[model samples]
Target chain A: MTDDREKRRLDNTIMEGLRSMPEVDPPKGFSARVMENLEPKRPSAWTRFRLWLTEPRSVTFTPVRMIPVFAAAMVLLVLGFYAMDTNDSGNGMRMSTIRFVLNDSGMNARTVAVIGSFNSWQAHDAAMRFDDATGAWVLEAQLPPGDHEYMFLVDGQKLMADPLAQMTRDDGFGNRNSIVFVNGTYEQAL
Target chain B: MALLAFFLLSASCAWAGDAGFVKMADRARECGVSSGMIGQIESFTAEGSLSDAEAVSLLLPLVAACADNFPLASFEDKLAEGFAKQVGPFSIVRALDRKLDEFRFARDMLQDSGGGVAQQALVVLGEGLSKGVPRQDFKTYVSMYGDHAPELFLTGLEMMSLLSQAGFDFRLTRSMLDVGFAGKGLSPEWRYFVRIVLVARQRGLTDDAIAEAAGTVLEDSGSLADVAVHLGFTSRDLSGRGLSN
Candidate 1:
């Protein structure tokens, strides 16, 4: 009991000595600076974007589920190559199908051929077949897109223009040649 | 050594009657004709449309054209057409002579305007000039693109020729073409402008009305489809279909 009393008296004496010390002032804005340091910091837009891009994630796809995606990619690749080939092969010329029809009222032509600038006015492979139902001569040909002047050659000798042609030009050979325009689609001249 | 070998081969080909085309091809090659053109000649002569003497007659101008580095396809195509038509060799030669004159005129005109031009440009210009497209109308473009981009002149000349063939006034045709030329990314549509006009004509629109419609579209820097729409026509109407009488 005498030791406990002595320890209490020493504690009271030290407390009294601390209470006797003078107070010291802190630097200006010290508390505000401490508060600012405690606040949460926000990253910049570029920093966030970089983090998002660099963040690792798992992409799970079963072989069955990916089959269609792979097929579509292959198709697109093939189509792109095909388009490139077409443009390169033709030197920018696109082909279109044109139907040439000649109405022979009573000429009873043995053979009819469409001849024009497209084929250099040649008629060998341009012969039209007779349609029994319509009694008109028709031939379909693949031509590059442009304006072409053509005429009907009957019996391998007589040349004449299409009666239903929208426009006719002087052939400079004392004859009229019908003009037909093709633009990468099926065109017909009646 | 190669020249002697060529001469020997040429002699052998000349001796063989069936090998007449080979002889002509050697001569063409000797005269600097392009191999592609030589092949074209071979295929044409193989058709047996011309006698050896007639083929020889046709060779002189062809060689002359080759030596001059002129557009030989035009002459070759004419020869093919003549054979297909079964015309007499003399008539074919006459036609070729006239064509040569036209080509010469076109070349001279282009040379006078600027300098050397693309062969295709010369050919289309020849056709246009012969068909009565005003030469004066082409001066602007010829001076602008004669050397670097003569194909532009070719395109312009072709458009003007088609318009002339369709019987449109030159002033109106040139004006419309000017509008098309000024617009960006409109060259493809210009290629089909004549087709649009043809469709309009088929729809019973008068030439004046057609001009007005084309003018409005051009003024707005519109496309060929726009011109069709302005005429109250659709792609279905413009797309070709069979019509039975």
Candidate 2:
């Protein structure tokens, strides 16, 4: 018992000495270094119990049974991601998936491309593909959030606006260009 | 990465192949279409008096000829509306052209005015245009909402459209707005008051009395609904029914 008391006294003295030492700011990257080296902490008993309480699992969930829940989770996830992708427009930077389609511009067309402000108005670039299912020439692109002016280049010669566009703008030269608004709502979580 | 790839893979199969679709000619370049919209279009063409080519020609230009980022879904919906009404292709196209023009005009106004709730305001603007609200009156509301979000602008236009639908002239609608939105931006209570005023007008209430009631609704501490009930439309006792009673 006497030896244990001496040891405690010595430890207290050492702790006092350490506490008396001057304080200083940690070196740059100190936090990063510490975090890199840190081990994952185990949860407390109460926390583990709370987690168990929250995570309710049905004992009857066979592989088939789990499929519906899994599918529902996936749908929610996709919708959530899509909503985020379409809505977020922070700091003037926006990203969105825009699908462009042209039904029937002309009977004799060799190539069709969507040229827009997003692609520096390149006529040949952003080529639309003839969709088999819908039978409409389609081009899907990721464009920034805003109003984009564009036109379809048909057969590498004719340029025309989207006939389905609800709004039209005079493109300086007698013709009009279709304007697309990309409201980036589906942002990637990563 | 694995989860994302899995999701993409699943979605790919979802836009799967279906029969009766006229597969794109090998030379044709189109993609991103998985819906059987073409078959439906073909079926629609079959139902109408026009030939397949003629129907397609009319339908195809609906989206293509439009300028600006018009919602294709909305265009399709309007097309459906026309079809439902049994309107002819030429008339439908003309109507669509007019609708697109209205959307452009409203879009330009919203952009120039600089406000939130633009979509709702655009709807209200369309209604106002249909009611023949003067260009100058639109300017008044546009300026009234200077640097403010479009909530009140939408509300104001909605009020105007209601008054117009009630057979009150554009001048009366403008006068009511001049009174209701006289203060700093709009209050939610103001809309309730507008409804109350509409009911009053329907009951043959004079303009002067309605304006006084509007002033009372704003100045008094009682809620707009309370004043609205005080006016009429509510199942209130007949004592407060000042004019038409």
Candidate 3:
């Protein structure tokens, strides 16, 4: 028991020596030196702009939240089209909504279509929808840029020309084909 | 100042020369014929062999009659052309009458079939008559392709005319038209088809070869580049092939 007590006393004395050593503080101006080395160099305006332009960015959105976002976008897109719609119409496909309109009143027609070179001359293929408000038949088709020969087919038969077509072609037979000179060909009112 | 003086001189001369073209002058004034046109008419009537009173009386109203059917300007141009050729007023009147008839015929045929005839086609019809492209040929082409697309049919006719001008035979021209118009100008414009004809002619490709290539291009090609690729011809290629074409 006396020997055990002596060993415990020796261990306690060594621990006290270790705990009592002088506290070592950092060298003078150490924090200032570290901050001076760590601080980055100021980039030039052009360099900063280069970085800004070339930087890749990630965008995130919830699928559920995207529904209203897409709906709003569609509404804006439709309104944009509406805003760009002009009272004047032309043969050019300058915009997506190039409307082909024909007015036939009191003809007792069941169907009307604006078939042209664009739709392989199949009358019912590009069938026109009747506009109740105007009592007219209208079809909106995206005609490719170039001259197009078209005619209106009434009720799947009775191929007719747009009487007011800007130009017409003699179908070498005994018929006149309505001509639509698309894109870049301007027609001034005679 | 010179222009004004010249105008005054011409106006006074016209007023003085009114003695010869009295009947024509009265009719011309009634039909809104320009003074410049009247000057040409009167000068032609005065210089030509026919009697001014008779030729003017007969021809001036004949031209005026065309005012409703054609642009009066076109009639004026034809009259000017006849004068430029030093043809007599009576001959000019006869030619104008024939042209008016042709225009009426082409327009009637167009209307009777279904309707899609171009005003420019009138000029083309006149040119065809002058170039010896038989009217029956025009009628045949019109009937064959007119039912589906009028402009395409007419454009095909024009393309044939152009190809013929480029030295391709009528068969080749017709063959090109048959193939190109088959697509209704959706993939390639009719003008593009004309370009193909020109290129084919430059390459000295046979009509059969051109027709065959055009079929492939119209079937598979959607652009001028695609056509060039399919036909194995380009603007660069045309230079080496032949510029005389």
Candidate 4:
């Protein structure tokens, strides 16, 4: 019994010794060191010019040198087409359908409603209906868009944003909205 | 263009050899042996005798072929030469055989005493057989049994060549020391003579040249201990060397 007890104590001591070894950590300012090493060095003007002049057989023409000529020709062509196609009638704004798709996969409820800057943040004015067959909640409203932010409310409890929609700035209360850009271009998410 | 051709040829040859090695590995695995064991057997067949160059060549490929099987970092040629000089080829085999015997005896004794010792002995024997013996010999031993003992014995000799190259002191223990005389009823003087033979073999000294070197070391140095010490060996092992003819 005494011998067994002594052996147990020795085993515990060895285990403790092994456990006491310190964990290894990466060196300090590791990210900054990596960034500093990876930063591109600027080449001399002569070296840059030599690199630009050497053309591979695959791309025989230099696109960088011809950009200005291409842009001037495109502007002249577009102006000529516009001069031939214009008609003088004020048919500008119309009440067209602006589709709202609740693309949040986390929304578990049967219905979702949009409340944001466009709808004066009103929940009752624009309630979205769930299409059970398509497995999606959608809303269609008439609105002229420059930029907007919106939030999705599901089952009167959970709040989320549409993952497939456009970007928006953060509201002070930790919520965000989907934005729409009208000129066929949207600002990318930051 | 020549360089490119050479590179292409070498690459193709390497690919073919890799495919061959894989086939050998599969056959070995099917036969319940490790690839290292298969390689060791192949090495022995390639070089019939345990000459220094033969040993060096065998060890190089065995290590390269089965790096995963052994705990060795790398075999050094100079070290092997040093060991070959210290312990003759015969003595090296005798030493390893002695170790295996002792391990077997220990295992038997443990079984007689209690089941625990037997279990421990078996574990030790298994580990020693796997790690200490060359993989090819071990595999051949397992697959072929009695018929393969001669080849396994030669494989053991090959191992001595490797150990000599690696600079291991085969006379480090009683079991290791008695290997050369375990079955051979060699007298003390004859054992000493065998030591000289081993040293000569290590120096690539032929049998006819032994008398001349033996006389010079004994006469010029008064004691074999002094000579062995001069040769970078511990003085205790000099007792294996025989005195004047």
Best model per DockQ = 1
- Please provide, for model 4 over B142-171, each residue's C-alpha lDDT reduced to its tens digit, 9 standing for 90 to 100: 233222223333323333322322233333
Tens-digit lDDT track of model 2 for B1-245: 33543443333224323211233211011322213334445677577664444344334424342335544444444455344334565555554455556666767776777663355566566545533455566666677754544566565666555444444455655565665555533453344234355456657877667665655665443444555565665534212211111
Worst 10 residues of 2 chain B by lDDT: B25-34
Name the runs in model 2 displaced over 4 angstroms. A1-190, B1-40, B57-67, B71-74, B114-117, B130-133, B182-185, B189-198, B220-224, B232-245
Using TM-score, give the best candidate's number: 1
Return the candidate ranking by lDDT, descending: 1, 3, 2, 4
TM per candidate comes to 0.64, 0.41, 0.43, 0.21
Better structure of 1 and 3 per lDDT: 1
Better of 1 and 4 by TM-score: 1
Residue B122 deviation, candidate 3, in Å?
3.9
Question: DockQ scores for all the models shown?
Answer: 0.09, 0.01, 0.01, 0.00
User: Chain A of candidate 4: what's the TM-score?
Assistant: 0.43
Output the lDDT of residue B103, model 1. 67
- Candidate 2 per-residue lDDT, tens place, A45-112, comes to 99999999999787755798889999999999998997685554455565666778887634546678
- Ten-residue region with minimum lDDT total, candidate 1 chain B: B236-245
Off by over 4 Å in 4: A1-93, A103-106, A183-190, B1-245
